[model samples]
Target chain A: MNWILLATIAALLIPIYEAWQDENIWQTMLAFSSIASKTSIMILIVSVLRDDWTLGVVGVIILSVGNAALMLLAHIIRRTNEL
Target chain B: MSEQLYIIPIVLLLPLTGCMLVLQVNPYHALVIRGIFGAIAALVYVLFGAADVALTEALVGTMLSITLYAVAVRSSLSLRVGAIEDQLKAHTARELLSVLRATFSKHHLRLEIVPYTNLLAMQAALRAKEIHCSYVLSEPGGSPSPPGGGSRYDIQTRVSRLYEIMQAEVPPTKAYLRYIDLANPDKSTEVPIPEAMEGKS
Candidate 1:
């Protein structure tokens, strides 16, 4: 279980590095979406590890809300590009 | 008991992402990194046994605040320049617009076009502070200044900082740049055109 969480943290670094180095706004957004879902997944894993129901529920909410935020951001950015 | 090993690294990730967020130079890119920071913060909060705090951070900090800030940055970081509608279709107008875009982008400001039906309407918008600048096409040797009447273009800006910026970057030959002092009531805002100006937005 510890190894699983450690590996997930390692995977999370990939997107962070990508977000930092990429100059394109869309690419940074892509990395942000990746990091958002990955972090929420980590929260869920922690919940399962500790058997905490509240943490589990929060994880689910964050997971879904993150994607919705991404959708809103993408639309605004697209309008900017068109204009 | 041995689980303490990964906790240090997980907590370390917080500062790592935080640093990246601070290092971003562009406002739009910074906002995206801010979302990334909020996500990591929520995860760290949950790790520290603060479930409710984590939930608030993810919802308000990540989702709600990011959306709001993105909207604010997109709108505020732009310079609104008004132009007469029909004159904008001219080939010279296109060249002038490209030059304006190139100059403004260097300062991280986006140029937005606000079209008005006529010269009077555009001047009114500028005096009302609805636009930061206005582009006028004057007639050859300077008169009437009908839409696309001449190659000569006039760039008028009420803002001093914008005037200074353009005064340095935009050459006088390309377009005649003027700084209008709106505070002085005596200064004429009127162009010599005789109601011949027409444009579309």
Candidate 2:
């Protein structure tokens, strides 16, 4: 279980680096999208390992809410360009 | 704490992204990095057995705050320059526009073009402080030729600070910088936000 968590942490680093290195806003956005989902999924895995129902529920909510936020942010960025 | 070795790495990620956010030169890019920071922070909260804190971090911290900040940054980090409808179509105006855009972006400011029907309306807007700046082709008799010997544009700005920035970066040959001091204290920038809110309410 601990090894699984370490692997997830390793996976998370990929996007953090991408976000730091990419100069384009959209690419940084893609990295943010990746990091948000990855963190929630890691939370879900931890919940399953610890057998915590509350943590699992929170992870599920974050997963869906992250997508909603991405849409809102993308729309705002698009609108700025049109003006 | 051998069983919690993963906690060290997870917690360390917060500072890593924080530094990235701090180092970012662009406002829009910094906003995206902020979202990344919030997501990592929520995960850390969950690891510390703070489930409700994690939920709040995700909903309000990451979701609501980033969207609000994005809109705020987009609107605030902009420079609006008014030009006459006829002036914008000219070759030299377009050249000056490109130069202005490049100069402003280095300071993380976006340049926006507001076209007006005529010089009278454009000057009115500038006097009312409706626009931050305006430009018009210089008349040969009105102003001497720049050393480069091409037609020049006058970049009139009410902002003293903006005049300084433009003065430092924009070439003298492309445009002449003029700072307009609004003598009427009542009509200057101080009152518009509250006045508009009062009108709406």
Candidate 3:
């Protein structure tokens, strides 16, 4: 559990580093996805530590639906550019 | 106390450090940095055994807001043009480019021009979406679209507006208005998406 917390803290810095390094829209999107997945994983880890399935279910919902919404928003923005 | 308790302060401190780093980045990069900040906050929540709050942060803070920021970035306006070499050589075609520049400038759009070797090459570029609008010279009496046949095959979205501009501005030529089917408003040269991909979510 201690190692998991450390790993989560380490993973949280990646998007900040990426944003500081590059300004391209694609790079920003990749960073966002990395952060999303990492945070969801952290939620799953904490729920396990607490012996709580309800909290785990919330993490699972975010893991499945969150990235899809981001993808859909990207698609919509691309469509607006076409106009 | 368990050794895990020591990790809590470090976890909490990470977001504050990240916040300072985010402030250092430019506004465009800052938007991306905020997503990282949200994830770190979620991690801090997890360290406190507040799994529900961590889950909320992961969904609402990290993903949803990042998508919104990206959508804003993707809205920049642009237009692309493609033409074959022979068509570009025509005096009227150069005039057409000037007209296009003037017209698109009104919309504050940046135009990109690509030159191709032949009509087929231009068509291929159009299909690949390397360029939004393509121009080609067609010889009169070219039945199935001659190599240099004068025809502009445009995407459905931009075709009508382009046709209106061409009709009003471009001087009549021997092959003028030969290929575009203004007669039937619905026909498109490109094939629709495949059935298999269309059925997928």
Share of real contacts kept by model 2? 0.89
Per prediction, the TM-score for chain B is: 0.83, 0.86, 0.39
Backbone clashes for every candidate come to 3, 0, 6
How much is B7 displaced in model 3, in angstroms?
3.9
- Residue by residue across B1-201, what tens digits does model 2's lDDT show? 865889999999999999999998888888889899999999999999999999999899988999999989999989999998887888999899989988988888888999999889999999888899999998877655565568888788888888888888887768877777788545333211234323433
After superposition, the stretches of candidate 3 with alpha carbons farther than 4 Å from their true spots are A11-16, A73-83, B3-6, B13-28, B69-201
Top-lDDT candidate index: 2
TM-score of candidate 2 to 2 decimals: 0.89
Task: Give fnat of each prediction, in order.
Answer: 0.80, 0.89, 0.52
Which window of ten consecutive residues has the lowest lDDT sum in model 2 chain B?
B188-197
The better candidate by lDDT, 1 or 2, is 2
lDDT of 2 at B6: 92
